[model samples]
Target: MLPDFRVRQRDYLLEIARLLTEELDLEKLLARILKIAIEMLAGQAGLIALKETEGWRVATAHNIPPAFLSYLTPLLAEEKVADLDVTELNRMLKELTYTASMGLLNGTGIALAAHGQVIGVIFIFRNYADLFSANDKALLGSFAGQAAVAVHNARLYGQVNIEKQRLDALLDSAADGILILNADLTIERVNDAFERIFGRTHDQLAGTPHAEVIRWARDPIGVPLEEAITDGWPLTPNATLY
Candidate 1:
């Protein structure tokens, strides 16, 4: 029975890890994580507090009261993983005049870190009588690490896409012709201007050797080597561009 339980538990943990690492959208991933924590770990309430300039903000939450989250901000200033006992929970909630709904305040939290830098924290509050077990604490610890890495990767991918779009737009609007060559002398890129000036499509010029794509013959009027090359240049043998 223990072996079977272990196998099933490992499978579920892998699924959660996959979701945390594979989902590239930050908000969507956070929503999924909170939902999974509530369901899988039997958490009645959950929230992910991401560290920001002003302070920790509730980036995402499920069944978590705004007031309760506001109260946790100061404690979250110190990053660490901890399984909250009733003693500590009561101490933190002493001023709130705890309500019946707040009975499920026993749970665990972990600091979200990426590449050794703390980025955020995640919490899943469970029933006071049924506090988080050792297994639950370990699982949530693994989740925190995976979620942080996903956030970092998603941010990087978004920035790269934005920069690529910006560069493409700039190149398309440029007046001067531009051709970028690879280290092997093959054409890496040709801007819209280059395509128009050479009277060739981008697809036709790309990946072609510079020597084969450009006519390197002597000038008919004895113009200098560099001056001899002009806009109406014809392509060499085996060249697709005219």
Candidate 2:
């Protein structure tokens, strides 16, 4: 049989893998990861604080008292995990509670990075005297590794949605009929004007070959832009549609 710690690590990693496969929502994914962290470590309370250009914001919170939220936010802001001291932490807690509320004061922080740069940190905390073992840190780091990629992909997905909306608006407001083609010379988008002019539904033309759509026109030109250019006329794929 495997060691107890190894078994626990396997369980945690399995959960982390499950998190990676879920729907692409950055906030929800962060919350789920923090929840798993607390469950794996028996943490009483924890929160995920993400770094924004404006400042730090709480992405998710679990079992963390509102009072503690204000205190914990600034503590992790200017400092990394290495800089935190348990004795000093409890000393600060002394003012808030009658006695030492924190027993062990453990935190595992993982730096989330994208494109070779530091983006944010994932922090898990517990209020017990027992220190986190090497195994615990390793598992937490692995969790962060996968979490970073998911978060990055979610961000890109959001950016794509925004760009799509802008492109749609531009196409809708344009004076002339406009159509865009994919690199493979297939119709990607056709505006309202294009549909009206062509007397066909835009949805019908999507994914259809640009050449085929133009072939249906009155003049019946096979290729509108068929010039194997001589000089630097901005190289494009053999012009299937003008």
TM-score of each: 0.61, 0.71
Best by TM-score: 2
Structural RMSD, model 2: 5.5
| lDDT measured at residue 100 in model 2 versus the true structure, 0 to 100 | 31
Which pairs clash in model 1?
Answer: none
Each candidate's number of clashing pairs is 0, 2
Model 1 agreement with the true structure over 116-181: per-residue lDDT tens digits: 876666767775667677777676666667767877777677789899899888988999888777
Candidate lDDT scores, in order, read: 0.67, 0.67
Q: Candidate 1, TM-score vs. the true structure? A: 0.61
lDDT of 2 by residue, 1-242 (tens): 99977788778778767766774777777778788877777777666655665545567888767777776566545545224343343333333332335434555566666677555566666676577778777777776777677777777777898999999999988878898988667899999889889988878999998778766436544433433233322365553434
